[model samples]
Target chain A: MEFLGSNWIVVVFMVVATFIMGFAMAGISSVVGPSRPNKAKSAPYESGIPDIKPVRPQFTARFYVIGMLFVIFDLEAAFMYPWAVNFDVLGMGGFVHMMIFVSLLLLSYVYAWKKGALEWV
Target chain B: MGDQPIWITFIVTFVIMIVLLTSMAYTTWYERKVLARFQDRIGPTRTGPAGLLQPLADAVKLMGKEDLIPEAADRKVFYFAPMITFITAILAAAVIPWGGTIELFGQSVNLYPTDLNVGALFILATGSIGVYGIILGGWSSGNRYSLLGAIRSAAQVISYELILGFSLVGIFIITGTMSLKEIMFRQHETISFGPFEIANWFVLSQPLAFVLFVIAAVAETNRAPFDLPEAESELVAGFMTEYSAMRFALYFLGEYISMIIMSLFASTLFLGGTSGPGADTYWPLGIMWLVLKAIAFLFFYIWLRATLPRFRFDQLMGLAWKVLLPLAILNIALTAFFRLIGNGQVF
Candidate 1:
């Protein structure tokens, strides 16, 4: 228990407990709630019209583009955390390196902005 | 309950969960009552005094409602997804420190459930995991509205979540660590200015980061104004269109729990968690202070919901990528620059 790493045991216990709680909350409903299912009730809700087509609909390409940019930028954030944590030890040199790293990412972000990659309806 | 062998962890976890569940339930009531006041109407008043027991009433009512699973839905995924959301949201709260370590019955125990070295990042990771519930649940529901909700959530999270990650870099630079307890402790310290002594709260030093964090945190939780994922008018409950009974409650719990957790996280980072008059001497006072600060943040969340309209998906994305992200990055650079200069490491 003295070891700092052992604290995660509490975390694991918490997660498992919370997950069970989630299940129990829903399970209670399943056991106690009414279950008279009809075709109208089972149908997927889309205003009032009944659907013949499959549920798979095409999404905009912009979501994909945004997802890609997220990967790039959040990874930048991940990389920067360590540098930020060690800011004092690394000094001016680390500062300059991080600036260069961030500026390059910003430049790409600006490129995306100018290219209208960020535009959405 | 005094000393136990290996049950300390269980006890701590139990207490934290109780606190979170109570707060989460009340947050719904708080939002409705506050929002109603904003609109000059009375909210739920018949359940209990001032509708105080409305959450309990709502929970009991939801239990009697039919558990409607769409015939075309993927049974396994829909069933599993809500658990993912609820679990991850509660798990994130495990890292939030209620106060510093203290002694009771000759045993020293930490005030929080657990203090991880990467406590802040742990919250972020859990939040990212919570999104999967919406994405998978929506896609597996076999509804077009739910699918659109899923797509919007994916896009919204990617943009807002990125800024959310970057917004904390300034705090990391200022505190020189990612452990939320240490950051809170750092802010709790007093500094001398002329003849005045004031807390070194990060909000004062990193005002820009604080502002950016508040915005991103709101968007990250998918709350009102940022709640395009569940825009009732446009998407009819969004990803939850096909959900019924307590399955819907699971998502509701997830959202409310995450809201309280984010408020706790924000109070810890910016408002000096567990810090108040005599808090250092009496540890329980610290918890009181933290709760007060978290409640203030919760009020802010409700206020925003009442005051503002939902953002267009395009505008939401543009704000994240174009405005908040750059500002967050700039905050990081500025903090690093000044931090080094303060240390006499940079001229």
Candidate 2:
């Protein structure tokens, strides 16, 4: 098993502290604040008219396309992080290997850009 | 790296928490005052001397205001969503190095909370998940405008986040480490250039990456010019539309805190964080430099807000995919070639 370090302990404390911080902010506000409720007040807010709309509206394909592209490119970038961090030890051979890999990803990116899949209004 | 006592660690962590929270509160005041001066008006003059207590007063007022939940809202998600943004933003600050270790009461106490080998990656990962709060909050509000706002934000965040990650790739390749503390220290190594001695800050070598990073960081924080999600004229505060009182206050806090964290993150990565004249002899000067650099970046953020117009949605997406991505790739390729040259692998 990988040994747990002191750094992880500080991190845990930080997580716990911030969690409490959020709760304290919200909890104090809820307790100290008033609770006067009415129909008009509870309605979903908008600028002027505040009209109610259809529930869970269907979104266009543009969002999903962007999401998928993000997943693909983000993964490619994630793969590069370790390689970049080890660049010095890895030397010229690693440099050539990474360049080839990144160029392929860029080519694919270019293909996506040309396919009209990236267009949004 | 040291086996410090658990109690001491706890105390240090607690202090860091207080600092992050306090800096976040003051950042709001700083932004307002800076923007006010830019517009030729004094901001928050009545609350206290120079309105220094305005953030405190605002916090009390917000806490006292009645909390509201829309009748059609998902009560659980709406209640919890703001916390997601708040926690993630606050968590990133834990890894930021305030300065080198300081000797405190016969004990060597590190100025930073922690230094993960994957510190840079940790910040980016938190940033990636940070958008879920917006997406979920908007969806749960049960309104079309909220839904649209969420969708736009999801798209915007993902696109810009890619640029943010890629921009750092140049620094990673140059430094050969993802640890923020290590990156900062690496930048402190001076290289002589004829008449002038210069510290090897990444901003000097990888200038393109720095520019890309600033643009991407501003968009990630949803500051003006990139504040499409919360564009009041369009989506009416976007995912924040259906929120009020304490929940609203948390989101507001989260944004400002994220701004501060991003500023610190940028300084740590590119500006030779905590490395300044006299910083070697007097350690507090390092912290002072860190604060000054972060504040400068924060000022730059407010300046952009006061200067630029918001980008159209399509234009924002296009710039990320078409412009920034290719430039980032080019930067990586150039850095790699230079690395090879430095390694004596190329003539």
Candidate 3:
């Protein structure tokens, strides 16, 4: 009820517009476009090929390990962006929070290395 | 508290959100059409006059489809993932100063919801919360690609978020206020450079910071040139591989909404939010001017998507930490020095 004010009228128009537009478009397309539903047509797309066997490939956990390593470093980068942006304004609080974040992340990086997640094959 | 009804603000925001969502949904169609034009092919002309209804069709298809949950996935986290994404997307829109106040009941109410002194910081916080959705969705998926994509997503957000935040510090130093509404209002008091207007828009004064902000924003939103996580050629839809129906749509909506939020934020922060010619004289004109500016940024987002190639994970991280981080910090230093010298440098 609170969200039913006049201001919400614009939003309601938006929602209805999106819904009506989307439904109408898709419905119209279905009517006009060819609808040939075959077993082969419904199969999971694999570049126009029939699957011989379900291939569950095995990869060295190394792919995941390196990925995790990348994430750790990437997260470090993320925290620094805002801290750097707010450094002057935030002053000591910003600096301290950033250091703490870095320290915690560094510790995890060390742990990952100790756990051998950084090794290449 | 304030005298104006909270419901009024809520209703206003709700409507804005709906408009934003629908616009984002159609942006997808626009992007496809534009990209198709780039590739020399027609895209979706069949769905209501020039394929304008394509986005609507997409939404219906997604909603009507069966919602699937993997057996190995954690149901609690799985369900919460989409909600988390959606919330983060909506929450970040709170601080964007859409325009100046509008008169209602003999008093004027600010178009923005709340202008915390720590408005920029608030954006950062809410923006970071979005990572939780991707991380949880990836972990809960019980699929390797999804997991990898999620991890990549977290890293990407984390990496670029820093540079992004850092770049804004320059703006803060120059403006000396974190409240976006205050910043816009402050812009009205002009600094004349001998009959030639030199300092009005932050983009005019702090071009470096503006460029860096746009780059970091692109990375943060995981758009192309930084879309490694969701690179269809590689990860098969990244963290959303296993998702289906409306659940998948939630993530989709989150991404587009976040883009819109960023565009609005950029408009408010750097492009004078709602301030323009005759903006000071009329309230509604100010709002229109703001929306027009914001739409410019939105078009830029679409333009970039259509033009740029997705960046490699390594290159993205490198650009953020090595390049953008240093550049942002440098801008901050310059702003601070100028502020100290003049006590008034246009940010």
Report how far residue B193 has shifted in candidate 1, in Å.
Answer: 2.6
Clashing pairs in 1: none
Scored by DockQ, the top model is: 2
Name the docking class for model 2.
Answer: medium
| Model 1 chain A poorest 10 in a row by lDDT | A1-10
Candidate 1 regions exceeding 4 Å error are A1-4, B1-6
Q: What is the TM-score of each predicted model, taking all chains together?
A: 0.97, 0.97, 0.75
Scored by TM against the true chain B, the candidates give 0.97, 0.98, 0.93
Off by over 4 Å in 2: A1-4, A48-53
Candidate 3 residue lDDT tens string, B1-347: 13457666666666666677778887788678877887788988998999999999887777666566665567789866876777767766666776666787786666775555666776787788889989898888766667778878877787777767767776765666777778777666567778876438888778898899999898889898788889898888888987776778888888988888888888877887777888888878888888788778877877787788788766776576556655765676566556545643234
Question: Which regions of candidate 3 are displaced past 4 Å?
Answer: A1-121, B105-107, B344-347
Q: B183-289 in candidate 1: lDDT tens per residue?
A: 99998899997899998888889899889989989998999889999999989989999999999999999999999999999999999998889899999889999
Q: Every model's DockQ, to 2 decimals? A: 0.72, 0.75, 0.08
Docking level of model 1: medium
lDDT of 2 by residue, B101-124 (tens): 778898887777788888999899
